[model samples]
Each structure stands twice: as C-alpha cells, then as structure tokens.
Target: MNVLINEQYDIYHVAHSGVPLLRDVKQLNPDVIIIDIESPNRDMLENLNKISQFAPKPIVVFSEQQCANTTINQMVRSGVSAYVVGEVNQKRVKSIIDIAIARFDLFQTLKQELAETKQKLSSQKSIDKAKRWLMETKQLSEIDAYHFIRKVAMDNSQKMDDVAKNILSVASIF
Candidate 1:
C-alpha cells in the first residue's frame, strides 16, 4: 500500500483499533482517503457516515471481499466513493483514486442541486399558500396577492419566500 501511495503522492496513516474521528482526517486535508480494511465493521461504517456528513472527502475502501449489497449501498450513500474488492497495487491505485474523486464530486454536486431545487419548491409552496389565504380572506386577485407579498418583502428587506411564510403564520390564528 505504501509503495503504491508513495509513488505519486505523500501519505499519512493513522492507526486505530476503533474508528478514527472525522477531525483526525480533517486536519490532514488529504485529497483522497484510502482505507485498507479486511472487513469494515458496523462502527466503522457508522463513523464513515458521520465523516461524510461533517467533512466530505473522497474515500476508497480496499477490501478482500464484497459485503452485502445493502452494506455496500449504505457505504456509497454514506460517501464511500469507491469500493475496490481485489488486490491493491501501484498500477491500480491512482486510477482508483481518480475514479473515486470524480464520483465524489459528482455526488456532491447532485446533492447540492437537489437541495436547492427542494428549497425552491418549498418557497413556491409557501408563496402559493399565502396567495390562497389572501384570495380567500381579503378577496384579492391572484396578481394582487402576489404584488402585496412582493411589496412586503421589499419593504422589509426579506426574501419573497420569507414574507410569504410570515403571512401564512400570522394569518393562521384568524
């Protein structure tokens, strides 16, 4: 492992009986992480999930045999970028890392875009609810309702989404 890693890039190895903390890895700030584990235990997998959420980095896991499909899926979902089940060698190291990094980046981008889309949908829902409230209670046209929300947002220096949410909350009691 050292021979393969040492050829192209510097390496840092932290030995631990249990799972290493995410902070330990964060401090190193490696471009990619390579873990050679005979079998990834439940605690290790859980720690990987926490690490993925806290400080995302491309991770390559080299194991002797593939675990259950559910476990493999969980690892991927938890940010294990590449899982290699075979012998590790100098020839394969760089390519595996490259693939892992690429996949990690793609996954992160997708996750971010999905979050943004969901936020936009939530905002639109809020705006629609507020507009419906105004049309029912104040007898305003849809256009008028939208204009009122926009005006309030502008006056208060807030986002239209925020203003819409405020309208819904404030009008809820009445």
Candidate 2:
C-alpha cells in the first residue's frame, strides 16, 4: 500500500475493521477504497454488502487467491466494483483505480435508469386506476376522464400521479 501512495495519490485514511467499517467509510468519503486480502470470508463479504447499501463508493479488492465463481458474484453483488485476483504493484494501482471508478459509474447509471423506469410504470398504473374510477363513478368516457384528471392536476399545480391518488382516495370513501 505504501508503494502505491506517492505523488499520484496519497491515502486519505487507513482503517482495519472487523466491524463498523461502513461507519468509517461514510466519514472518510474517499474517492475509492482498496482492500488487500488473501481471501474474503463470508463475514467479510456480508460486511461489504451492508456497506454498499449505506455508503456506496468505488471498491477495489486485490485477492491473492483465485476466487471461485460464487465468490466473484457475491463480491459484485456486495458492491466490490473491481475484484482482481492477483498481486498489486505501484505501477498497476493507478490503472486499477481508474477502472474501478469507471465500472462504479456505469453501475450507478444503470441503477438510476431502472429506478426511473419503475417510477414511471407505477405512476402510469395509478393514473389508469384513477381514470377507471372516474369512468365508472362519474359516467364519463375514458378520454374525458383522462382530460378531467389532467385539468385538475394542472389547476392544482400537482403531479398527475398525486392528482390520481387523490381521486382514488375520494372515490374509495364512497
């Protein structure tokens, strides 16, 4: 680790943890974390997973032993972005950090897109339910029901989904 910490990049903080590693990482807010371990045990992998949920950052793990398929999958799921099964050297450290950061960024982008898609789907479902409620209760056509909901949303300066939810709530009371 010392060899890699030179003019290019210096270590922000050093910590050895059996537990509570996530707390330290959250406080440090380092750009990347590099873990040098012979082979990660189940406890270590679980810790990494927990850390990923709360304090997400680029993680690079250098393992001395060749990792099994399951080990690699678990580490990836647990938020280790770059898992290299080999020795590390001063020259290689910078490249590894760059790769880890790139991979982490890609993962974040994909996650954000998935979340957006799900939100859109949920909103659409709610809007459809509200449209159906209006069609049945108000004796309006589907298109008119949709227009009424849109007008209410625009007049109230609320999102369509919020307006839809309001309509559903009021309809359910009767």
Among these predictions, the greatest TM-score belongs to: 1
**Tens-digit lDDT track for model 1 on 1-174?**
232333455545653434464456445544344443333533453355464643332222333232335544544554543422223453455565544444555666888999999999999999999999999999999999999999999999999999999999999878
TM-score for all models, in order of appearance: 0.54, 0.53
> Which tens-of-lDDT digit does each residue in 1-174 have in candidate 2?
332444665665666575565566556554445553322432463355454654332222333243345544544553444422224452464465544444554666888999999999999999999999999989999999999999999999999999999988998899
lDDT at position 43, candidate 1: 45
Q: Output the lDDT of residue 145, model 2.
A: 94
Alpha carbon deviation, residue 79, candidate 1 (Å)? 6.9
- Report the C-alpha displacement of residue 135, candidate 1, in angstroms: 0.9
State the weakest 10-residue window (summed lDDT) of model 1. 57-66
Candidate 1 ranges beyond 4 A from true positions: 1-87
Q: Which portions of model 2 show Cα errors greater than 4 Å?
A: 1-87
